[model samples]
Target: MKAFLILEDGTVFTGTSIGSAREAVSEIVFNTSMTGYLEVLTDPSYAGQAVVMTYPLIGNYGICYDDMESARPWPDGFIVRELSRLPSNFRCEDTIQNFLEKNDIPGISGIDTRALTKILREKGTMNGMITTREYEDLEEPISRIKAYSVKGVVKATSCKEKYVLEPEDSKLQEPVRRVALLDLGAKKNIARSLVERGCEVTVYPCDTPAEEILASCPDGIMLSNGPGDPKENTEIIREIRKLYESDTPIFAICLGHQLMALATGADTFKLKYGHRGGNHPVKDLETGRVYISSQNHGYAVDPESLDPSVAVPAFVNVNDKTNEGLKYTGKNIFTVQYHPEACPGPLDSGYLFDRFMKMMGGNE
Candidate 1:
């Protein structure tokens, strides 16, 4: 089936429908990852947005049950240059199109993805409309695009209830290490990573009270990445502040990093276009080493806005000089403005997960 992608600026690109035959409107953004399409599709960070893959030829590895970041795919729609019809992998159970079809998500393929990526890069991200067939007057779609908002995206994509994905039945006799995870639209993989390391994870909603969390007798706390403005999520800061009363170790990523800074009396602000790719370069201050990381956020923690006495800058973006990570001098809290889980690309920061595990007194 034929499809058309219309940008907010009246730019249109024709393509072929590859997934479910449906029309939708969303903020269009591009990612530079060459693999891990399953993780990208399931990541809640892409909620309320239509993702355009810069790398051509997606779905080569096929879809498996293990790589999902969330319970379901969150992108309003997906766009790519090509979708492989026949997938080749031992662990593959289904094709990309089948997965999207099962989830009622729409997608467009056979378009000029390189051009689309370039446009987003030069013009910043913009709202876009994807239709299975062309329409006569583009006014309605354009109007819808203008009115689109991702403010409550985290709530929409978040897990309505909690569940667990443990590694195996190996360490049943050991003391159950506890980690309180604040699910600000958290990804399943992060929780799985902690569980795999033998920690009994208790996932909580974004607004869960600090008193209740601490009452659970947690050895550590984790802040999750999510969508929307960090400043607007003031309630999370209040929760973090209450957590700071104890000596429990705390770790945060992406939006969680932003909230951690805000909780420490720092501030956060929006970026011009934000970083949404998988090849962002971040430099660690203590180690003096640069690591390629996966990032997906539109707001960053302002180092200058931080209370100088409370938190110190721990990392910086090598390309844009933006603040990337922070560490509390008086407490055991630390955060990074990027994805260290490496869902789609460079695993340089995967060690950070192990660091968190070690902090919680679990064997790495």
Candidate 2:
């Protein structure tokens, strides 16, 4: 089927539908990652956006079940320059096109993805619509795109119910560490990381109350990554403020990082186009070591808004010098804007999980 990606700014690019034929309206952004399209699609952080892959060729390696970050795809749509006719990989379960069809997600291929990426970089990301209709019939969608806003995206993507994940390797006789994870649309690997370290993980919904969480008597708390503006979640911020006030060790990632900052009276602002790839270079301020990381968030904590006496920068992005991580003074709390679970990319910052383990252990 034929399709056209129409931006709110009156830009239109014609292309062919490669997957589901359904139309999609979303905040269109571009990703520069050369591989791991499957991970990109399933990441909850992309819940309200449509992705344009700048790598030119996608689905070359096929999709693998192990590469999925969440239960299903999150991106409203996909744009790629080329779709591999035959995906070749040892662990390939199915082709990307088939996966998209199964998940009811739309995709467009055979377009100039590089040009689209350049447009986003120069003009900043904007709302867009992917439709099978001709350009002449795009008036309604254009109006729709202009009025579209991502609201309640985090609540929509978050888990509906809480669950527990025990250690993968139960043979170890070590003392089981109890960790309560506040799910703001968390990835599976975050829980896996805790389970692998012998921590019994209890994942709560985004709206889980602070009193209920503390009543569980957890050794530590983990705030997870999700979609949309952190400030819009006023209730979550209030709960986090209460959580931080107590002695329970807290570790936050992505959206969790932003919410925690807001809880501490700091501020956060959205990026121009946002960071959404696996090759972001981040430097640990404390160790002065650079590490390649996977990032997928549109907001960053404002360093100037933070109380210097209460919190300090732990890491920063080398490309833009934006704050990447924060360390709270006189508290067992820390947060990072990047993914440390590695997922489908570099594992340089995997030590952050170990640091969480130490925090939980020391508090015990």
Candidate 3:
């Protein structure tokens, strides 16, 4: 069936429908990863957005259920240049077409994704609609697209109940450390990363209070990545302030990184076009080392807004010189705006997880 992608700017791209026939309107963003489409689809961080894959060909390797970062796909819609009909992989269990149909996600394929990405790059990210319905007048859809905003997405994507993940190695009699993970729409791999390192991870919902988490007597705390503006989570930020006062080691990622900054009196702002891909390069200030990292966030901590006495910039993005990580002064806390537990990206920054383990005294 014929589908139309109506942008907020009134530009419409015609394509063939690939998923559900239902219409979807969302903040449109693009990702540059050539592979890992499955991981992108399931990542909780994409909760309120429709993703445009810049890579021309997608799903050639098919979908492997083990690669999923969350329980279900989170994107409001999907856009791609071409959709692979026949996937050839030894571990393939399902095709992208079937996955989208089962998940009820609307998508458009065979469109000029390069041109769409160029427009987004020049004009910044904007809202758009994907529908199989033909419209003679684009005024209504464009207005609706412009009016859309991503809100309450953190609450919507977060886990409803707390759970625990034990160490992956059964041979280990007791876990090396106990970790309290505050899940702000966390990807499953975050817990798995700690578990693999022999930590008993207790995953808490985003709304869990600081006192309750402190009562658990965890050796360390982990604030996870999520969706939406960090400033909107004032209550949670207050709790994080309490956590900051504690001596227990703390490590945060993405949205958590932004919230940690806000809790400490630092400010955050939306990016013109947020980083969302597998190959973003970040440089560690302390070591002067560059590492290709996986990232997905729309907001960033304002380095200038940080107080020198509270924290210092630890890493920076090579592309835009934006803040990528921070180290709290006189505190056992460190945070990064990129994904260390990369599901579909380079593992160069995976050592940060080990650094967290060290902070928890697991290495000792």
Candidate 4:
């Protein structure tokens, strides 16, 4: 069936409908990754956004059950230049088309994705809709797009209740650290990553307070990534400030990183166009090393807004020279803006997770 994407600017790109017949409207963004479409779809971080894949060809490897970052797909809609109808990977058990249909998300293919990406780059990310409209006029869609806002996204995707998971049997030894993972729409891999390293992880919701979390007597705390503006999460930041005094060796990624900055008296601002891909390069200031990273964020910490006495730059993006990480002074706190648990990365960032373990005396 014929389908199209309508941007808030009244731009329309024609394409073919490939997923469910439902209509979707949300913030439109683009990703530059050439693979891992599965991971991108299942990542809770993409909630309330329609993703345009920059890579010309997608879904070539089909889908794997083990590759899901979350239990279900999160993107409101998907756009692609070409979707592989017959995936050839041996581990593949399902096709992207089927996955999209089952998850109630729409996918539109055969569009000029390169042109769309260019428009997003120039205008910054904006609202869009994927629909099989009855008419060609875009007035209604444009108006809806202009008024739409991605609010309450984290609450929608976060776990309703706390859950626990022991270390995986494949670990070298029994679990040592008990980690409190605050799931603000967190990806499953965040907990899996901790479990793999022999940490007993307890997942918590976004509304949970500092006193309640501290009662767990956790050896460490992980601020998991989520969707939306960091400054809007004022309460979480306030609780984080209280937790900071404990020097609990907190490790945060993506949204967590931003909240940590806000907790430490730093500020955050939205990017003109957010970074979303696997090939981004980052330089670690402390180690003086550069490594490829997997990233998905639209907000960043303002380097000038941070208090030098409270926190120091730990990592920075090589492309835009933006602050990518921070290390707190006189505290056991460190954070990164990229996903260290994302697979098919440089695999060098996982050491950050090890550093968290070491802080909790799990380095043995």
Top model by TM-score, which number?
A: 3
In the range 1-364, model 2's lDDT, one tens digit per residue, is 8888899988898889978888889999888788889988998888889999888899988999988999899999999999997998899999999998999999899888888888888888899988887866667778999998888888888889988887767523266889999999888889988887788999999999999999999989999999998999999999999999999999999999999999999999989899988899999998899999998888899999999877999999999999999999999999999999867568888888888888988322
Stretches of candidate 4 above 4 Å error? 169-175
RMSD (CA, angstroms), candidate 2: 1.6
Worst 10 residues of 1 by lDDT: 164-173
Angstrom error at residue 250, model 1 = 0.6
lDDT for position 188 in model 3? 90
The TM-score values for the models, in the order shown, are: 0.93, 0.97, 0.98, 0.97
List model 3 lDDT by residue over 76-169, tens digit each: 9999999999999999999999999999999999999999999999999999999999899988888888889999988898899988887866
Which tens-of-lDDT digit does each residue in 222-299 have in candidate 4?
A: 999999998988888898888887868899999999998998899999999999999999999977899899999999
The parts of candidate 1 lying over 4 Å away from their true place are 162-175, 361-364
Candidate 4: minimum summed lDDT over ten consecutive residues — where?
167-176
Instruction: Note the residue pairs that clash in candidate 2.
Output: none
Question: Ten-residue segment with the worst summed lDDT in candidate 2?
Answer: 166-175
Better of 1 and 3 by TM-score: 3
Question: How much is the lDDT of residue 339 in candidate 1?
Answer: 87
Per-model CA lDDT versus the true structure:
0.84, 0.89, 0.93, 0.89
1 or 4: which has the higher TM-score? 4
